[model samples]
Target: MTSTNKESNGSPSPSDSSKGLWRNLQFARMFIAYALATFGDWFDALAIQVMVAYRWGADPLIIALIPVCMAVPGILLGSVAGTLADRFHKVRIMLLCDVITVVLTIAILFAPNAIWLLPLLTLRAMMGVFHIPAQQALTRQVVSEEHLFQASSLNGFVAQCSKVAGPLLGAVILAVFSPQFCIVINACTRLISGLVLWPLRKLVQPKQWEGKGLTGQTRTETESVLTQWVRGWSFIRSRRIILTTMLFGCFGLLAILMIDYQFTTLFRAIKPGNESLLGWLASSVGAGAVVVILLLNRLPQIGYGWGLGGGFSFIGIGIAALGWVTPLTPEIWVIVWGLCIGIGNGLSMVTMNYLLQKETPPAFVGRVFGIQNSLSSIVLVVAPLVGGILIRSAGPSPAFQYIGMATFMIGIVGIVLQRVLWAEKKSPVAALQE
Candidate 1:
């Protein structure tokens, strides 16, 4: 067989350059399934937002609650979910989550009104709590370690592509059909994705926990949920680099959340009554992210330190610039800001996550990632409410200015902390080399 044909048939192992693009048929199936599922998620978000705003006449903060519902579960259940991911067959867990999410989506179709959305959204979020870690763990299982960065980048790319497409499709669907109909379509998409994953059972091996001996150990001492949860924290504390990286992530997410909220509000101000413009702004961000992914794919040897710091610096400067440009005439400057944030977000996400994955021990991967997700969710939960209040009290421009300043300060702090940590460690490059 030709080399290409051998690779296609899962016979020839992939080289680093082709790792992300040349997944085996089984991995390709899972990738497509994940892409479709993510599309369904974004579709649901767009449909639900429009339904809540136009039909229910909900206030902006109230509308924000929809995302809050989605994020809260990830924050609360993340560690436990990570533990479970390490303990169970990850693919089976993912399949189960997809099924549950599909059921929840269908339930939303029959939801009487916006009020009914809360409960359904809660269920969907809970499913995500199970889905995300399992999905991450499974990706590690299917790919070689050298390919992990590529796999992660490709995953981010697909997610960004969905963000670009799903809302626009939902908008077209909403114009032609009801939001309930969009929900139905989402349910169908999720159902098909779930079915596609169901047959991949052989790909998911049981975790190392199954091999551990604790025959005479008490449940509390051996397999307690509390112990499992604490184990994640303990793992973090033992690794100085991991702890430092997580701290950076926490501050970075806090700044990112502030920027995200302010940018959405700024978009409204810049193009009053033009919701499609907001969609375009979002698409611009996704487009920027796609560019970052493509660039990183070509330059695999670059370290995370420069990418993380530089990306945050760009985001900070872009956010600050938005405050200055909002008063200008053309109004397209908002799009430029959107593009900057998008590229910055994309680059930062990939590099930071790659660093974490590379540095973290395989046994603790789920827990570390879970903690990162929880930190981001916690920031998401708090930022919007506080941002709204700040805007109400001090107007949009000042709120954005404050956000930019805060983000900049945080970036500076991250840089300083990295320097200090490096200085303290005798071998600075060792921590980052991972």
Candidate 2:
């Protein structure tokens, strides 16, 4: 690793180094496992959606149910998953989920009836509900606190890479093979992911909490799932900044979902003869995310300031591009929207993950992230249905315009709040303490 330094207030600052990606062997294992798992996830999603659309002649409305099914589980089971992550050895939970998912995928391959499709998809989604929080919690356990930001950035980068490659590979596989075969391949990926994760069992040591004897037993027995679900909100009540960030995230998620629907519909409208355009557009978005991730790792200072601002700007521009859709040049508009939204999502996701890791204690990180995931899932569920209704009545252009306007308002609010916080830091009372 190389080294550098910063000086502040006549004090010598710590030197910077490469952060030595290989320092945490267990973290690397987890990253590889997650990347492989995501590849399978993305592949299954794209392949199944296309298969259903082609074989069953399903429209966008029906296909939208696929995402809805996946998100529904997160909304319902996220808190439970978080609680489990906190209580158990997270690696064990993750490995178990992986095995369950693989079995479910194999079952889907063997029983390939349209009637069985929804149930199989729902089961897969349920496995994901457990897998995500466990994986996140285990990552924290494996790496040092100082390396968390970079680890998160790298994880985001790998996941985006999977998104880019998975769909394209899936499309190819579908051209030559059946959807059942794709399901089998997805199972194979999960199996390999599980194998990779098996070696990290030692890293996730279980915590031993001191018991309060009968009082603890009584409280445990009396606690309900609803109480656990609301615990995240209670924790966030005092964290004004994080709460505001989550609110911004909700708008960002809404904008992203709107663009997703618009992209699919627009591609179908513009080049209905060539469905490959949808995959290409999705790949473009993934490419943009990859670019942002790389830049963030290479340029930390810029990532902390302008990179964050640029991300929100990209989101605003992306939403505006969606509103500009015209039949005359829809492809160009789709690409532009993909680029902007991709960059925006990449920047926002990495920064938010970093902030959460920095501010939250290890014991509560899982619950906090679970809440964030659930909130995003809820927004996603509502966005498509509402977007579909708007498109039906007002037309796609106006629907997109409405989404864009709302996103821009949220971004403005975030910027204003940031400035207020900055001003407070610069005030005389704050300065005197310094």
Candidate 3:
């Protein structure tokens, strides 16, 4: 197997690399298309919630099922999607998924009731499950190693901006127009993303498959999708750096997910009359993420340990402070805490992407992300239920404190483990190649 350094002199300086990354037409196209698609996703997400809770008058249990519908596809088909991303041309997969999503988003507009909407939502989410891994894999193909962190930071920035902007725009549209209108807007964005990406079919050429397959055979023959799917999990397990980061990352996720949804309840307790502040509070988190993404882009380097550990710690501290909010507590303080968590969120995400690209061989990048998504789905399903029970019985105050501390500890432990486990500079891609 041959690994060509895309940048001259083995590694280009950070400033040069950043400029090159922006100049790369493939990355530029992807960035614009991804931003449009992500904004549309968040817009439709808010639209769906309003449609179910307000329009259809869904009960709490039914409303809770919304996330379950979205998550179930990732749990079931995520790894399979990854295998498909690895087996086929990733650009084609991304383009196909975008087109399918455009169709499904339009179909969502016609659903008269929650029953019909749920299935369409699930199918749309399934397309996302396929789209994400393909996008991540393609990113590895286009961005050189020197510029990966910048690319990751830029992507995170787009996502954070979309999170803030999409819901706000959706709210405005929903007030002036209708949920169906918002759904239509989402469909148009998807269509636009597809059109933007269509030209990449002729432009970005993927590296030829040069290494042995994960099943210990040459890439001359195709492996069954099921075999690749199963091997994806084992492949992660075989690499210590990937496995450790993934496990600890999920731990942090469990801690965050537990308290994330309960913020509304907490806000209600602190300031019962102004549930509207919740929007500001949520936007604050996105603001924090954007700040951190910008900071990361300016930095010459990012340490994986610092990104994961510091991220966990910041979020943990913020969440813990958030638990202490009382009627007497100032609203400004709460927004500050939310901002802290957002910074951590951005840091961890960018680091995770950077690590995956740095460590995983090109052959297995898609499967790695797919397996990660599946694991996250498991945490997503379990965390909310447990958090709800804890909050119901113990109240949000104690629940936040406990969960926040646990999250903080996860970060501290991650740092200590990184020191021990990564004492040697291990090259997972090189090891896999051998």
Report each candidate's C-alpha RMSD, comma-separated, in the order given: 5.0, 7.1, 3.9
| lDDT by residue (tens digit), candidate 1, 322-376 | 7765544465766787788788778778877777666554445666677777877
Q: Residue by residue across 1-434, what tens digits does model 2's lDDT show? A: 21111111111112222445454556667888998999999887766776688877776666767777778888887777776665566788889999999988888766544457777888888888888878776666555555667777888898898888887788789889877678788899999999998866655242322111211221264556556555556666655555656776776677657656665665565456767767666777898899988877764323332334446667777776666766676576677777887898788778777666555545456677777778888987898777777777877666667777766665665555665422222221122223
Q: Per-model C-alpha lDDT, please?
A: 0.70, 0.68, 0.83
Winner of 2 and 3 under TM-score: 3
Q: Rank the candidates by TM-score, best first.
A: 3, 1, 2
Model 1, position 131: C-alpha lDDT score: 82
lDDT top scorer: 3
| Model 2 poorest ten-residue lDDT run | 4-13
- Per-candidate TM-scores read 0.85, 0.82, 0.93
Candidate 1 — what's its lDDT?
Answer: 0.70
Instruction: Sum up the clashes in candidate 2.
Output: 0
**TM value for model 1:** 0.85
**Where does candidate 1 stray beyond 4 Å?**
1-21, 56-62, 204-222, 267-277, 412-434
- lDDT, residue 78, model 3: 83
Sort by lDDT, top down from the best = 3, 1, 2
Model 3 CA deviation exceeding 4 Å by range: 1-19, 203-209, 213-217, 423-426, 430-434
